[model samples]
Target: MVLGAVVLWELLAAFLERTMDESVYEYLDFVDATDSRIPRRSTRAPGLAKALSLLRGDGRALLFAGTVFLVGAAGSAGHNFLLWQLQDQGSSGLLMGLWVGLGPLAELALHPLRGQLLRALPGCGLELLSLAVLAAQLLSYSLLRAPWAALPVQALSGLSSGALRWRLQGTVGDVATPGSERALLALLGGLCAAGAGLGGLGGGFVLQRFGLALLLQASCAGLGLWILFVLIVRSRLPRRRKINYSRLLAAESSEMSDSEEENEDWLVKAMRDESFNRNWIQQHGIK
Candidate 1:
């Protein structure tokens, strides 16, 4: 059904662009509406004349779509759980974003090898690291009376989260082959959406019934189970090569080392061009 909708959207978007000369956002709206009303199965009809929309097939469009996708999910997660802390801890949606952004910040050391390392490692490894931190953070969150002291725990959760997230996506992509990629990606996306939807529901339930302490304890234990599952089951996924993070960033800089000038040149260039270095500075502002 989704695939058929994609095809229909492609056709309608093509025709609408040619006749109405619409914007991509307009096309998006039309397609969204169409998606809502898409019946079981019925097709045939090329629609109107073709028009090459600016946003449809462009190379940069894919990048934009991917970014929009991730940001939407991340934003939703923040609004659901962390935003609730505002009543007691003065935590807002923005605060949650700021704090969780820390884990990704800490992963600066692992950025270059993200895809490579994820493909090499088990999904369980990332899940375990994430759950361990999440468990600890949640425990601290419930234990501390001081909200300011607890805020750093959220940041720690974020750092661990960032690494786990990056690894998860990479591993999921790696798990599905060319033959099954589309269905696998769709399944993965649906699972994510389902989880988020459940989280929204479950989070509210926790706040209402069990209270913070019980909720935190449950969250910790739940994540701990995730760690166990990953360690036992996901660790056995098919792998082409083994990855070693420590070896990649070696301390024995005795052989085939770059000159001081070359190293300094790269460092300076990176510092000048990098823009994502804001998360660290933004985190403290949340508390």
Candidate 2:
């Protein structure tokens, strides 16, 4: 039923795309404008070598990539062991499914308050706190023998994994170069996949030999060490400047005449100019 629903959803999406007017997709204007401004000589997709060089040039991006890898590994290890731990505690398949579903439900519940949470906590600070929460969740999983007792710990996924994803995307956007944003994000995805694979392999090995308790305990300890390392390293690095996007957009909109606003060429030019200004500001390290 789930697979059929997914297939039907895809068909509906395809139909909508074919039937919808191009003008209705407003975000496409940004993509078109960006492409229009690119030099004919440099219109090719970003090469892997260029992307790697870009990553290497940005200190914050490098740090973020390393942090993402570690977090991914720890998160994957915990997830892979969760069912096994529950099964050992004599949890039925239905109960185990509920345990798995609760995390995403908690994440969904957090969506409404995400903006307020982001406003209340700085990005890096929120990320660190999320890591701490994740550590706690792992510790709970390690120690709790009662399947029901461990169910509450899954709710921590909202503040931990969910928040981490939000922070990671925002941080990537902040650090990435104008044209290199996609490449950097793709790199982030690659790191996540690699980390998860390694985590699953190593976790399974330990779980098979030493047991789930030992694996979860070790994951918790390693994550704790990573959190400390990130704290120290992040403190020594320069703080990321938050872009006032609302202000930038308002200023741009105010400067445009009504006739210019109506012109698609003018709109595209304005977006291109905004992109150029952002690139300049990032490159120059202007406060």
Candidate 3:
């Protein structure tokens, strides 16, 4: 059923893309033509070596990647232990399915509030909050005895997993150069897979030897330590201002279309003027 849903979603996206107005593509082309800063699409795809070189050269990107790897590891370990713990407590298959389903439902509930959350907490703040929520979930799982109790704990997955995924994408876009976005994202994906593989392997060994409780507790402790380390390092590092790409793109698009500019909503007009756009981008510390 899940696979079917995913397939349907992809088909829907492809349909929408195909049916979209050609003028929209033209406008995007105009924006790219006008904006010298916009990275041109490269003919050759970036390789793994290029992606690794990006991480090596960019300190902030490297730090973010490390955090992602640790989060993936801890998250994978906790998830495996959660199912095992539930089984040990004699949870029915139906209850286990419900527990797993609740996470995505929680994420759906939070989707409407994502913009507000992003506005309220910029930079790595949201990412840190997600990690903290994950830690709490881990701690709760460690102490869980009742199968039903796992449902509520799994709901935190929305904030921890969903929000982390969102912020990680934004962070990557912010740090990535024009042509490196795909490569960087691919690198992060590989890192996440590696982390998950190791986590499952080591977690299984620990679960067999030390039991589920110790596995959960130790994963929680390790994650907590990582959170603390990130906090310290973040405090010491200079903060980089993030660009609101959506707004910038909208403004640029509106400016490029003179006819549309006059009919644009008030919000678009706010940044419609060239001077205003420049000032806005500058204020956001974009070169």
Candidate that scores best on TM-score: 2
lDDT per prediction? 0.53, 0.80, 0.81
Which residue pairs clash within candidate 1? Answer: 86-91, 103-158, 103-159
| Candidate 1 to native Cα RMSD, angstroms | 24.1
Model 1 agreement with the true structure over 33-124: per-residue lDDT tens digits = 57778632243121111111222333332222233233234333344554455446665666566665654565675567666655565534
Where is model 2 more than 4 Å wrong at Cα? 1-47, 240-287
- C-alpha RMSD for every candidate: 24.1, 15.7, 15.2
After superposing candidate 3 on the true structure, give the runs of residues whose Cα lies further than 4 Å from its correct spot.
1-45, 241-287
- Model 3, 1-287: lDDT tens digits are 99999999999998887668446655655576567665555433445777888788766677778878877888887767678778889999999999889999999999898988888888778888888898888889889879999888898888998898888788777767765676678799889888888888888898899987787788788878888887888788776676999999999887889666565765566656767889899999988
Per-candidate TM equals 0.47, 0.71, 0.69
Cα misplacement distance, residue 73 of candidate 3 (Å) = 1.1
Residue 98's lDDT in candidate 2: 85
Candidate 2, TM-score vs. the true structure?
A: 0.71
